[model samples]
Target: MAAIPAPLSHTVAAIDAAYVAAARNGDSLGVSMSQVIHPCDRALFYQFRWCAAPEPATGQRQRIFETGNVYERRLLDMLRMIGCDVFEIDETTGKQFRVELAGGHIRGKMDAVATGLPEAPETPHVVETKSANDKSFKAIVKGPVRETKPEHHAQLQLYMHAEGLRRGLYLVVNKNTDEIHAERVEYDPAFCLAIIARIERIVALDAPPARLHDDPTKKGAVECMFCSARAVV
Candidate 1:
């Protein structure tokens, strides 16, 4: 038999759809570090400089995102289970570590602020977790994170710089094998400054910046097929 279907925007009842609707509506908020390191500068600019937002994430995409949250929590437990000290929850307000930039136009939360891990032993490091399928896991292991996914690498650097941490412990789990890959990321002041400048420029712009790629008709580019800001380009 086929597996049960995840709820769709139209098919679900009001009670069932409420949470999903809230999650979708939340995307209408500000930018995050995830977009900072994207190869397409114009896409980032368009997103922050008053261009229209994309369609709400699809049900499958939402489920995949939700699954990543579950994996993050599980990884946190594994770290604490192995005798590491984790400070993901604050005792006072019971919220995770959050940092805002450009007066809260951009923000990102730490997966966990941890210490006493076997890898980084004694330093309080920003802990970022990720789960990827077999192929992407292998690629991440085979190359430096800055090379594999500049976005993740840049986000880590920003987290470390903003949080006053010198380094970070980047963690990734292979979804297919449950295997883990760990990398230590050091803060790069030059890179962080550049990213901050880029963000400021985008926010100050009255019109969308130039497109990173030419018109879709100019070159049969693949990114245009998936771009939400294409119309604004």
Candidate 2:
């Protein structure tokens, strides 16, 4: 019998092969993998990713609203003032930068990613912003001080991981209060490695994970609220 390949080696090779095939076919490797691992989830993920970006359908409406709203505007201006280069990722472009996850997959577009600023004597900051209703915004602000939400942390971590950054900055605003708070966060190599491992597990799974919840409740809230899955789920 042939010896089995190591798990890491197998996964890396799978990813590489998938990417090669996708490139040759002029398709997205991430999208191709999504078809293999979780077709339903990928469809939803694709929608949410684009909705958050600059799109013709929205006609830059999202940015307009964000700038018009007091709190959001302030946060946006502040981010820009800090020299953050804001950009959007459409669904098509997003698929090219996919990362696999356990029992499923995870992908993101950098809302506003900045680099080339002089590195601080201290760790650099990776900032993420969110706009939410009054009640939910307050709840998040008051929630147990756990650095930032793990999911947001994960999001920023992925950005940082991709950009080779070590530190992060987070700005969360309350639409009602027009208040903006900032926090500094450091990178956790362990957490990133765990996320990568989870992605590997997701890809290796025989079936997709359960459909994600689409409510504002704790467990159900994070991934789905802003996801395209909400529409169909």
Candidate 3:
């Protein structure tokens, strides 16, 4: 008889344990630009103020993040293969391109900046990448990033605004099918300015803003379902 196969469960458990062990909690560095676009102001306030501790990232979540990083690297390589001049780091600082506002409280990093695109050879554009599962990929493919994924759109806009660029190259990969969707996103000054104003106001507030809904089950309160501050707020 063939030797019994080792339990796959043990290997799976070890992988998960490794990811959990390496997870790090976020610092109390003002509001992240990535998070400032959250619809619920109170939630943002609570997060920035550290009123409630966020749940540690699950092993599965870490794995997903790593997968996204891999895809992003591949996307950048493809740009270079096509003769685009891609800059992933700022030469002066030897760090990823970053943006800060609200006295350095609101901050974010750009994935890359590239020129020599097939459409615009001379114009430099901020590069942003994302990987989504099939369902999400379908939704985003249906409409522009601003309409389908406002948070992502907000991030790209902020990056371009800080870089003083007029356009951004947004790329998203379908994790399931390995398909890519690319779009050119124009910077919206009005939108960026409004968000910056809100960030400044939030940083100065002594109290949390009103909840999007008193009832978590309300139609517009979907974000309340997984809110880290749900218990405290």
Candidate 4:
């Protein structure tokens, strides 16, 4: 088994410190850390839901959507079961770490960061947990797995870039079967540029794009089911 890279250890410490700071502020720093460390295709899917339609529906759909979180928790449990060191970072500091992403950087107090099972010590793997979002998950795994997504790869690539890591592991859990699917991804600069272009367009526009509906009339839309914006819309 290959040893965990020294640089990756430093990166993990930096990331953990950021999360610790963010949690202290009662913010979504953990969520952002989810993006940096895991960089799964589903993360982009949620971002799309947030940007396209902030509000969708409720009731049973909401329950189904809530399974995403449950699956993530279960996946974390599984990792712990396998003896991985899993830490919850501070949410507020997490946000600051994300802000650094815009400029292609990562900053935090900790050093000697590491990922994967410390006991096993193979090629480092960062596991991303997802629930029932098969489409996005497949898209990421389909080809030679690249670091970026068509729309938001920049954020993911930025994470890998900052960490000085080249590979990632994506773990997708099926809600119905409770089966865990795994895939390997490698970093690619071309793919990263494509995703960066998409984000740039979103940021440069005077108003939010029309295709990204903040509120849709569709009753069964996934975005409506669990979005925090559901109440206001």
TM-scores, all models, native as reference: 0.85, 0.49, 0.92, 0.48
Q: Highest TM-score, which number?
A: 3
Q: Where in model 3 is the C-alpha error above 4 Å?
A: 1-8
lDDT (CA) for every model shown? Answer: 0.78, 0.51, 0.88, 0.46
lDDT of 3 by residue, 37-114 (tens): 998888888888888876777889999889999999889988999999999999989998878877777888889999
Query: 1 or 3: which has the higher lDDT?
Result: 3
> After superposing candidate 2, which stretches have Cα over 4 Å from the reference?
1-74, 82-105, 114-123, 143-148, 208-233
Q: How well is each residue in 1-233 modelled by candidate 1, as lDDT tens digits?
A: 99999767564455345545656534434578788776676777777654767566555566678899998899888989988999887566689887777666677887878898886678888888999999999999976898997888988888887888888888999999999998888889899888887787777777666766666655667666577778763
Ranking by TM-score: 3, 1, 2, 4
Per-residue lDDT tens digits of candidate 2, residues 1-233?
99987567677666556544443222222322222223244443443233233222332444445454455346657766767554333356663234433322444445454443344534445556666667866766764323425566667676666557787666687666767656656677777776566555554555445665434456735655554444543
**Residue 171 alpha-carbon offset, candidate 2, angstroms:** 0.5
TM-score of 4: 0.48
What does the lDDT come to for candidate 3? 0.88
lDDT of 4 by residue, 1-233 (tens): 99876555667666555544443222331233233332233333344345334333433344454567678768767777876665434355652223233333222221112256543356554344556655655554554333434223333344455556665555566655566766555666665555454444443445434323434457655645544443432
Better of 1 and 2 by TM-score: 1
